[model samples]
Target: MSTYAIGDIQGCYEPFRRLLDKIHFDPVKDTLWIAGDLVNRGPGSLEVMRFLFSIRDSVIAVLGNHDLHLLGVAYANRKPGKQDTLTDILLADDREELLTWLRHLKIMHSDAKLGYAMTHAGIPPQWSLTEAAGYARELEAALRSDQFPVFLKDMYGNQPDCWHESLSGTDRLRIITNYFTRMRFCRADGTLDLITKDSANEAPEGFIPWFAHPHRKTVNDQILFGHWAALEGKTDTPQVYALDTGCVWGGQLTAMRLEDKQIFSCGCDDV
Candidate 1:
């Protein structure tokens, strides 16, 4: 038996499957931990969702920004932009089941025994792994409860771009969601630089990559994360894994065997 951590699929199902084949994945024995962005911007989101749902018990995934966008659009009637390609999923016969399952997916996942943790994006500098887990549960509780629709409506924003113990209501959930899904660069005090999406070298004058913050609380744990394809899986940090290799942008789909950290990839060829 083996475990593999996969990068953002972004709906590039063919390359995702090919990467799995490259790794010779066997559902019966090999489990998967996905860094999220399983849908949108590619041609096969519906297929990806269906397949993942089929093997739900063998897979663990955090929700990516795109994944949340899909939910917002689906349940909260949030409008879609031009680049959005989630119509197939929205129109699928199993859309309800798929979206429901997606809504319940975690924003952070960890295994002490495996000595690794996973999130769609990096944790905030202010949060230790323990705090991250608690925040994730709070967001998940709101998402899984009857108030989910209201939460989804409030979930879209870049407000309160910093963390504080005093944050409450939608403000708290929004900040928590941003840290787990949309974050990349931030200040030492955990203030997110939401407007900057460039590579680490180009981070704003007073900002640094979240994982590079001097006082980041998760330094002792290995972190697996996606959502910053601009890095192309490079952080120059041994314990930090940036798995989004831009498969939907014609890059490659990547997977790493957990036990040995060996990588497997398949070209997307822009779908």
Candidate 2:
């Protein structure tokens, strides 16, 4: 039984299916860990969700920013933007079942057996694997609770600057969620810098890509993530994998077999 980790599909269902076919993934035996962003910004959000649900028993996925946004949109009655391909998901006949599945996904997974910690965004410098997992669990509980919609309505912000045990309510949860879901670049002191999404060279004076920080706390655990598509699949360490190579933007969709380190990829079609 092999374990395969796939990068963000972002609603690109054809490439997703083709990549699985290329890898010959067996739902009955093999397991798949998705690096999230499973739906949004591409042509087949609903198709991807449905297909993934069909194989849910064998999949482990951490929720990404887009995935959270999908929930936010759903709870808040927000309409899809022009660039978003969320219409299919919002109009799906089995939308409740899909949303329920999405809500239960975690933000971090550290499989001692696999020797890796999987998240959509890298773990922050301030958090150990244990701490990160705890934070993720806390937010997961809140998101799945009846208070979820209230939390979602107030969840879009970047205050409290850094992780602090003292911060409470939605502010505390949002901080942790952003670090594990939306973070890309950060200040050297480890504060989330949410504004810039540009080439690495163009990062404003104090910002550096989150994983490139000198004092990363989860370094001892192999951290595998996506979400920073502009990085184009690069990490300073072989232990850390950045597999989102903009597959939804006509790049390659990739999967790596965790047991044998075997790699599989499929060329994406133009959306």
lDDT of 2: 0.85
Best by TM-score: 1
Candidate 1 clashes between residue pairs 3 or more apart in a chain or in different chains: none
Count backbone overlaps in model 2.
0
Model 2 C-alpha lDDT per residue in residues 1-271, reported as the tens digit of each score: 9999998999999999988888889999999999989999889999999999999999999999899889989987656667888877888889999999999888787799888889998888878889888988998898889889887787788786687888899789889888888888787556878888775666777788877777778666788899887877766665789878888887888898988777788889733
The positional error of residue 87 in candidate 2, measured at the CA in angstroms, is 1.3
Clashing pairs in 2: none
State the TM-score for model 1.
0.98
Query: What TM-score fits each model?
Result: 0.98, 0.95
lDDT score, residue 139, model 2?
87
| Alpha-carbon local distance difference test for all models | 0.91, 0.85
TM-score for candidate 2, please give it.
Answer: 0.95
Model 2 regions lying over 4 Å from their true place? none
